[model samples]
Target chain A: MREVILNSYREAIRDRVLLVVLAFGVAMIFSSLIIGPLTLGEEIRLAKDIGLGSILFFGLLIILFIGNRVLYRELNEKTCYLILTRPITRFQFIAGKAIGLFLTILVTSLILGIIFISYISLLTGSLQITAFLAVIGVIFQLTMLVGIVILAATFLNPFLGSLFTIFVYIFGQMIPRAILLAKFYKHLAIARILSIFHYIFPDLTYLDFRELLIYNNPIPLERILFGFSYAICYSLVMVLVAGLIFERKDL
Target chain B: MLATFLFQRSIPPIYHHSEPLAFLPSGPMVEVTTAPLGPISPEIIWLAAIQYYGEEKISGGKFEFLTQVFDVLTRIDPLFDHAYQFGSIVIADEGRSPEQAIRILKRGLVKNPSSWIPPFYIGFVFYIHLRDFAKAGKYFELATRRSGAPEYVYRLAAFAYKKVRLRKGSILIWSKIYQNTDNQTLKEAALRNIRCLILEEYLEYLNKGLQRFEREKGRKPEHISELIPEYIDSIPTEPFGGAFKYDSSRDSFISTTYLQIEKIIAYLNNKLHVFKQKFGYYPERLDELVAKGVIDFIPPHPLGRIYNYRFGRVIR
Candidate 1:
């Protein structure tokens, strides 16, 4: 399991897609400084806005595109067959791949987040503490997304799995509103469907610290702890489901 | 074989299906809200600008387009505070109609009462643009009362009251700041400045009325009351409840008792102007004017109570 995890981490680091995603995130943050003058109020606001937005957008893109393709690539290359021929169980293989992808996402997000914060601070002359925490929230959301993508890739082709994961990410952010709309509809079918989605998808809205950043409000420590716990539980559920599916698949 | 088939059937449907789950519902269901409308297009924003400005080129079609744009933006994201901020400022300042801006801001505040930006703009329009200090003060007061209003709101409200000569109102507002703020130096400085300013304005009006009387009559009045019929609508009362003093020997009015440093400054400025006009140059010292019986005594600075009457050459 340890060897598989190490190999997967090395393979993800060498992936061209990960490098492109990281570069795109850095470029977007740089572009924010150019756009800063056009916005009203202080220049710091526009820079912080772009920096926080870029981190979330690029992190999700990496999780969706690269994460969805990672497991499928191993299967298509018959690497999974070679690995399963070894003494390792399929469950261990799936866990190692998921852990490796999660670690890649974690490191990539942290590097981009630090660059974004430093650049914004340089431009604005004040560090946005809320923006720093918001980037962490985005990273947590992306980690949960990685789990969902791994689960989807276990049964679906890479393209379909990626599309579905993207759909889940968008809808996950709108879950509270969706639930409210469902209540207004007074239809059990719609409510049940929305409820199932609420349970299955990570509540990405919980990770939204954009208001705190914009208003310069301090995020409560308790709320951060709750959000961290939710991400862990949600990611564990997704990985467990993915492991069960991979365990039954024929090599 | 039968047992294997049964076990496979009992397994979750996810394990049985090699294909990806296609759970997306089919058909164009009737959406109650519709796709949160699109962003207000740039053309619509241009049209709105034109319509609001009453440009000759903007037709009825363009006016309708602008309304649609505002409607779409508000509907799609009501919490977009910039739309309210920029939109209301354009309406009030450019459109020259505070009523229109108030309507737009009221709608926005109904949706988001907790937002401070809209109220700030509203108060700014009333105070700065319209010169409606009372209404401006009310809006600013309301803004400061809100949960998330900035510290600047309180400061601005105090300023707006001062603009319209509402000294008591301004003092009341600043007193709130003095009570609430932790900065002892700032609070003390602000209180002192407010007291000085209120007294200064009062003395200024009296001095101007007195000067106007002297200009029109070609001689100084026997009493300040004699000028009230022609030069002033009413006598200017001192801010801190003291009568302005007049000295017959020096032929000058003084406000030293009430600690009106600003009044004394204005008196010196007027004396300097009169001296330059008479002698074709300013006095070498304020005492030269005292010898000429133009002033009874030079008033001291209110803050430091220091005499400051040395006349310097006018730079201009």
Candidate 2:
């Protein structure tokens, strides 16, 4: 498991595509400073929102386009055939990929978050602690996203897997809001089906602290802890489900 | 290059008082476009709205794309409190649509039940611009109970009640403002309000006494002092130490003024505004006040003449 993790990290870190993603991500985050001047008095807010939004966007791009292909590349190159014959299990391979992708996302988010915070503090003469919390929140959300990507890749091609993960994210964020809409349904059967769908869906918005940063709204200490625990717990469950499904694959 | 691209797009086609057509396909349209990106869609829209706001101001007091962009932003993230604040100002102050601004703020208040700033701003639009003190008081009272609100929100609430002539609802808040503030200008402002409300209170007593005297005598009193002792106590002194009078011919209660001529004109102008709001235009003349039974005769000016009504203003 440890060797699988180290190998995955080394492989991703050496990829030229990862470097390209990181470059664009970092540049996009810094571009907020240029865009800040266009707003009336919401300069800090507008810039920080764009910066944080860029980090989230580029991070997802890496996971969907690059991260989802990690497994396919291994299989196509017969690296999985070579590695699977060793002591490592298929679950360990998928888990390693999830963690490695999460590490890459964290590194990219940190670089972007730091650039954003520095630019904002330079502009405003004050550093907002909420900005970092927002970054931390993006990292947690990306963790779950990485899980969804890796789990879906086990069952489908890289393109289909990325497409499926997109639905997963959209559905994940919309479930809480959709549940509120369920009451408007007149039929009990329809409401009951929607309730079942709502219960089974993952909610990604709890990890969305970006708005909290924009508004300077404080998230209580306990809720922050709950968010961390929720992300970790949710991601572990996804990994567990992936392992159970991938362990018996004929590959 | 980016600016040119947006201008070429010319935003999207929109209909007046219709479902908003966002230049960028806002709210649900934006949500669908950025769905795969997660909740960051609204933040992206917020940034775009900022850019749009910066660019569209070249037009003279007209924001063709203003409501479309802001409406979509608010709809995308109803929790976006600052958008509500800035949206209302842009609509009210710049777009010349105070009613539209109030509508936006009211929806924001409903969406953000715990927020005080929305109600505070709503109160201000009614009080300062619309001069609908009752409407202002309703929203300001809502703001008073919201957490994280400033002390001034409460003061405005109190001031609104008093401004609408509900003098009893205003006393406690005015007293609080008078006692708590150390800023001389604010203290003086609050003190003046308190004195005005106090005079209204005293006037309430005098009015009841006059009614009693009229009922007993079957005619108006001959002298100002006739209502005193039997119908009331000593005459309540004017808050600014002026005298009171009774006019038998006009059947009017008159209060003498030591107020500046400008203030007197301002006071009469405010009454005229109220009259216009009621009758849909300025009264044909000050004597119309007697015909409408609003007052028995014209209020006296400090210059020993009637207020010079010119072009809808009572000038010196």
In terms of lDDT, the best-performing candidate is 2
Model 2 stretches astray by more than 4 angstroms: A184-191, B1-39, B47-65, B93-97, B144-159, B162-316
Q: How close is candidate 1 to the true structure, as a TM-score?
A: 0.58
Which regions of candidate 1 fall more than 4 Å away from where they truly are? A180-193, B1-83, B95-100, B107-115, B123-138, B147-316
lDDT tens digits, residue span B1-316, model 1: 9999999999873311111112212112212232211111222232343334232111101121233334434443456565666556444433345676676666666766777766766776676456688788788988887787877688778778777455554455456545644334335534664665666666676678877877887887788788666776776665445667655665556666553545666677787787778778877555445555667665544452223333342211
Please tell me how candidate 1 rates in CAPRI terms.
incorrect
Model 1, residue B11: displacement in angstroms? Answer: 63
Q: Please, what are the lDDT tens digits per residue for candidate 1 over residues A59-145? A: 778877778778898999988888888999888898899898888888898998889878867766887676678888888888898
Best by DockQ: 2
What are the Cα lDDT values of the candidates?
Answer: 0.65, 0.70
Instruction: State the DockQ, from 0 to 1, for candidate 2.
Output: 0.12
Looking at candidate 1, what is the lDDT of residue B243? Answer: 68
TM-score of each: 0.58, 0.64
DockQ metric for all predictions: 0.04, 0.12
